[model samples]
Target: MNKALFLGLALSLLPIGCRTSNPSTTTSTGRITTGQRNQQAQPFAKGADIGWLPQMEASGYVFYNDQGVRQDCFQILKDHGINTIRLRTWVNPSSDSISGHCSKDETVAMAVRARKWGMRVMIDFHYSDSWADPGKQKKPAAWEGHDFPKLLTDVYEYTFEVMTALKAKGVTPEWVQVGNETPGGMIYPEGSTANWAQLAQLINKGYDAIKAVSPQSKVILHLDQGNNRERFRTWFDNARSHGAHYDVIGLSYYPYWLPGNPDYQLSIDDLARNMNELVERYGKEVMVVEVGGEDTKPQNTYDMLVAVQRRVKAVPNNKGLGVIYWEPEGARSWSKYPLSAWGNDGKPTKALDAFLAE
Candidate 1:
C-alpha cells in the first residue's frame, strides 16, 4: 500500500498556565532581544508543536510539574529542557474541539508567548482550515474552486499575511514550514505531486512570500516517514527538477504509527541514513521536525529519543539540525493521542528527559 493510504488507516485508529508577568524583552519594533538574537545561532533545534495548546487550556486541562504542583504548561516544557515551540497556522479555521482553531491570530499569540518564554519559534503553515497531512491537504474553504493562477496567488498572499502578522507581534520564526507532512503535496489537486511543475510553483509561492517577510528565517519543506529513503529521494528529486525553493528538508518520524508499529531501533538507523543522504544529495540541512513514541512506555521512549538524538548529532558538520517531538505535552488523557510524552498526572514523562542528555 502507498504511504498516504497507510497514514489514513493509522489516523482512523488514532484519536500552559503559568502566568508570567515578566514584561517581554522584545523591542516595540517586534524584534527579538539581543540575547535571543544570539541564541538563534544555536546549531540544533529542540522543539514541540503545541498547536493544540490554546484549546486544551480553554477546555480546562491543567498541567503540573514533576513535583505534581499545578504549573503553567510552558513552565513544564521548559523545565524538561524544551527550547523551541512550533505553532501551526490555518488560514480561517473553525472553533472545532479537536481539529480546528489554529487561525493566524491564535498562531501569532502563541508565537509571542513562545518568544516571551525565551524559546525559539517555528511556524508550520497547513494552508488549510484543518489538518493537512500525507493523506489529505484540503484547501481552506474560502480558496475552493479557484483556478490554478488564482491558487498561486492564494498561496503567496496567505503565506505573506501570516508571516507579516507574526512579525507585527515581534515574533520572527526561526524556521517556517510551507506545508505540513506534504509527502504527496498540499492544497489538493492543483498543488498535488501528480504534477511536479505545478506543485513546485505552489511551494515556491509560499517560499518566496516567507523570504519577502522574514528573509532570515530558514524555510523548511516537510514530509512524513523520515526513515523512508526512497520516498525522500524520489520526492526531492522531483522537487529539485521542478525548481522548488527551500532552505531545509523537514521530516516526521513516528515509529509507533508506522504500518506495523515497528520499534524505534528498527528504523532509527534508516532515519539517520536518510538524513545523511539528504544532506549529501541536495546539500541542504535536514531536521526531524516531528517525532514521537508510545507515551505509555516512558523508558523505551526515553531510550529511543536518546538514540535518535545521537544519530542526528552524528551527522558530520552539523548538517543534521535536530529533532522536535510532535507534541510531547499533549497528554493522552486529554487529546487521546497515544504518542505524546506526557503522563496522566499532568507531568512530562521521562521520555522528554532525553533532551537533557548530553
Candidate 2:
C-alpha cells in the first residue's frame, strides 16, 4: 500500500495491445503487464503466519529453548519466512486455582517482536480461559453473571484496556479478532445469544471498543469447525442478518475434529468445497486462522497440512488468504502446567513443516 507499490502496480498495467508491429512484446523490464502478470503474480501475500505462547514458566513441559530462552523462537520463525504473528488474550483467565500463559502483557511483547522483525500481528481475543471453539464456548469468569448491559460494558472495557496497553507499547496490531472461534457465539447469555440481534450488539460492543483505540486495525470474527457449511451459514447469516459489524471472517479447520457422514477423505474435500462456497456466499476475505495436521505421527509429524493449504489456496476469488498453525512448534517444556497446550516431547514437532509448505 505504499507509493512504490502503487507505481509498480500501475506501470505493470500498461497495455501493449496488438504489439503495434514491435520487434518484441516484453516490457523494458521484460516483465508481463499487470493483467498478464496477475495470473501468476498472486499479489496478495501468501504463507502461514506464526505465533507462540511463552514457555509456561515452570508449568510442566521442557521447551526447546536456546540457552534456556523463549524470544529466540521468534528469530527462528522469521528465518523460516513467517511474516505474521497471531497472539491470543484471555480475560481473568487464571488465578491460584489456575495460571494463563497468554496474558495481555504477553500479547504486547509478542506483537512487538513480530512488528520489530517486520511481521504483521493478529491479536486474538479468546474472551475465555482456555481454547474457545465450537464444541466449548465458556464464559469468562469476569462476566460470570453480569446482566446483558453490564456484560456489554465489560467487553468494551477489556477490549479498550488491551488495545490501549498495546498501543502504549508501540505494538499496534494489523488485525484484531474480536473473539476467538466464537462459532456458537461470544460472552454467554448477553454476548453469546443465538439471536442475531443480540450477537450483533455483543460483537459491536467489542468492535466499538477496538475501533475507539485503533480505528485503522481490521476487525475479524472467527469460528471453528471450518468444514461445517451449515454452521458457517447459520453463524454468518445471523451475524449479518443482525447488525454485527466485522471486516474479516476467521476460521479454524481441523479436519480430524469435524466429522462428516460419508468418510474422512470425503469430509476434507467437503470442507474445502464448503469454504469456497462461503467465500463466494459472503464475499469476505477468509483466513484459516488455526490449522495443523497432528504431530503424533512419527513419519513427518504432519503432512496433511500441505494438502489442506493447497485445497484452500486453489479456490477462486482469492478468498483463501493464509493459514496459521496453532502450537505447531509447541514448547514441550511447558506442558507441566495443568492447562499447558502441548505434550512433553523435548522437541519442536513435525507440525512446523506444515507451515513451511512442507
Candidate 3:
C-alpha cells in the first residue's frame, strides 16, 4: 500500500569453462572462489523485494532476458547485480486464498531457491494474514482475541517455527523484518504505537526468536515514509526507550508519492540527506528497503535509482547498506503496479540498468 497518500488524507552467475587457472583465483572445489569470497566480504546489500514473483509466475507471467529469450526471474535480477532477495511471509493467509501463497511453506521454498542461486535472503514477517503496514496492522485471525501477552507469545512462536522450517531446508535468512511497515506500530490497538511498551515487548519477542534460531541473522525494524526524518526519530526513539532491539533500520521511499504528501513530502536529494542523518544518529546500518518509481517513465526511474545508489553509498563509514526496488517485476501482466520496472514484453525495462551503477 502507498502509505504517504493515505497519511495525507487524514492521515549471478557465471561463465563457461574456457578458463585459465590463476593462483589468486582459488579453485571452485565445491567451495566459494576467491572473487566470490571477496564479493561476500563487501558490507553492502544490493537487493530486490521479489515476493510477488512466485505468484506472478504461477499465474502465467514470464520473464525474459535482454535477448528476448525466456529466463528465470531470479536469474534476471542476479544478472543485473542484485545480490539479495527479500520475501514477505504471512501468518496462515490461507483463509484468504489470494494472500495465502506467501505462507510459511511458500516463503521457505522461495528462500531455498534464492540460497541455491547464491543470494542472501531477507524474510519480512507481516504478522498478518493479509497486508500489514503503517496504516493497518491487522492481527492474524487466530490471534485476534489474544491479549497483549499472548500476542507476544504468538509472535515468538510463529517466528521460531518459520526460522526452524527454513533452517531445516538449509535456508538461513541473512535478515528478518519483525513487522512490515510499523510506523503506527503493529497488531492494532494492543500493540500499536499508542502502547509503545507492549509494542516493544512484542518486537523483542520476535527478535529473540530470530536470535534463538539463527544468531547470525540480523533483525530489521521497518517503517514507512523513508524521507520523514522526524517520524523515524520519533518511532525509533520510542522503540529504543522501550527496550526494542534491532540490528538494522529499514525505510521505504517512493518519489512519485512523496512530492506532495503532507505527512512526508521530500525530493530525492532530501531523502539522501535524511538517510545520512539517520545513519549518524542511530549508529545502525540503514537500508532503503523499499523504493520504486513510475513505470511509464523508465528513464526517470533509472536516473532516480542512480541518485539513490549514490546517496546510500555516500553514507558515512558505509553504514548505508543498500536500496531495494520493491516488486519491479509487476509489469505487463501485473499492471496493477504502475511502478514496475518490467515492460510490456515481459522483460525488464532499461530502468533496471540502474543496478549496474557503481
Candidate 4:
C-alpha cells in the first residue's frame, strides 16, 4: 500500500509580538528595574505534544512523577527536562461537542498551562475539522465549497484570529505550523502539492498572518517522511520558487513507517544525514517536530531519542532547534498510539529518561 493509504488505515490518528510598550518601575531598595530587561533566549527546545491531556484528564486519567505521586502532567514533563509543549488546533473539530477537545479555546487553555510552567509553546494548525495528513487534508465544514482564492482568505483569517486570541491571553507561541504533515500539501485538491502555486499561496498567507499578529513568532512548514532528503528538497524548493516564506522546516520521523519502501529505506543515520543536509541546503533551522518509539521496547525509544538529540545538536551554529515526541503521555487506556513512551502503570517508562540524558 502507498504511504498515504497506510496512514489512513492506521485508524485516523489522529504567535507573537506587537511592539508598543515601555513601563519601568523602581524597587523600594533604590534599584531601578527597567521594563526593557534583556531576555535570554531558551537554549534548545525539548518538547512534547500533549494535546490529549485535556481529553485524557476528562476521562479521569492522572499522571504521576517518578516517585509515583500523582501530579500535573505538565509539571511531570518539566521535571523530566521538557522545556516546550506543542498543541494541535483544528479548524472546527467535531469529535466532541466542545469542538473535539482540540478546539482553539481548549488549545489556548493548554498553552496557558504550559506557559505557567515556563514551557514554550508551538501551535499546529490542521486546517481541518479532523485528522489531516499526507493521506487527507479535507477542508473544514464551513469551508467546503470555497474557491481557491476564498480558501486562501479563510486560511489567513483563521490564522490571524487564532494568533490574536492567543495574544489576548498573553500566550504568544514560539512557533506556528501552517499545516500538519503536509507532504502532499493540505486542504485536498485545492491546496495540494500537485498545484504548487495554490499551496504556496496558501502557505504564504499563513506566514503573513502570523507576522501580522505576532512578528516575533517563527512560522514553520511541516511535512512527514523526515528521512527522505529528496522529498524535502523537492517540496521546499518548489515552495520557495512559488514564494512560500517560512523560518523552520519541521519533519515527522517514524523509523518503522519511513523505511517501509524497499527502494527508499533509511536508517537513523540516514535521518541524521538528512537533517544536516537540509540545514546546509536551505540555510534554515530544522526540527524533528514529531517522533516516537515502540511502547514494547522502551530502551529502543530511549536510544532513538538520544540519537536524534545528538544529531540535532550537531548542526552547525545550532540550527537544529530540537526534538518533540508526538504524544508520549498516552499511558494505558487513554490512547491507542503505538509509539507512546508510557507503560501500563500509567506513568512514563525508562524511555522518557532520554530527555534527562541531555
Q: What TM-score against the true fold does each predicted structure earn? A: 0.89, 0.75, 0.86, 0.87
Error of 4 at 40 (Å): 8.3
Model 2 local distance difference test score:
0.59
lDDT leader:
1
Model 4 misplaced stretches (Cα beyond 4 Å) = 1-41, 96-99, 259-266
lDDT of 2 at 95: 31
Off by over 4 Å in 3: 1-43, 95-98, 259-266
Q: By TM-score, is 3 or 4 better?
A: 4
Stretches of candidate 1 exceeding 4 Å from the true structure: 1-41
Q: Which stretches of candidate 2 lie over 4 Å from their true place?
A: 1-52, 57-71, 95-99, 129-131, 259-264, 298-301, 331-345
lDDT of 3 at 66: 82
Q: What's each prediction's clash count?
A: 4, 11, 1, 3
> Who wins the TM-score comparison?
1
Instruction: Score residue 341 of candidate 2 by CA lDDT.
Output: 22
lDDT per residue (tens digit) for residues 1-358 in model 4: 0233542344243311000011222232212234212333247789899877777776677788888889988888888889989998887776542226587887888888988998889999989886678767888999989988899899999999999999999998988899999989998888888899999888888888887888667778998878888888899889877878787899888885653522222367777888888878876778999888778778878888888888888877667888999888876344545677887777888889999997
Residue range 20-136, candidate 1, lDDT tens digits: 011123332223355433343354677788887876788788898888999998988887788888888888876555555788888899999999999989999988887788767
lDDT of 3: 0.76
Q: Against the unseen true structure, what C-alpha lDDT does each candidate score?
A: 0.80, 0.59, 0.76, 0.77
Candidate with better TM-score, 1 vs 4: 1
In model 2, state the lDDT of residue 285.
57
Q: On a 0 to 1 TM-score scale, where does candidate 4 land against the true structure?
A: 0.87
lDDT of 4: 0.77
Can you rank all candidates by lDDT, best first? 1, 4, 3, 2
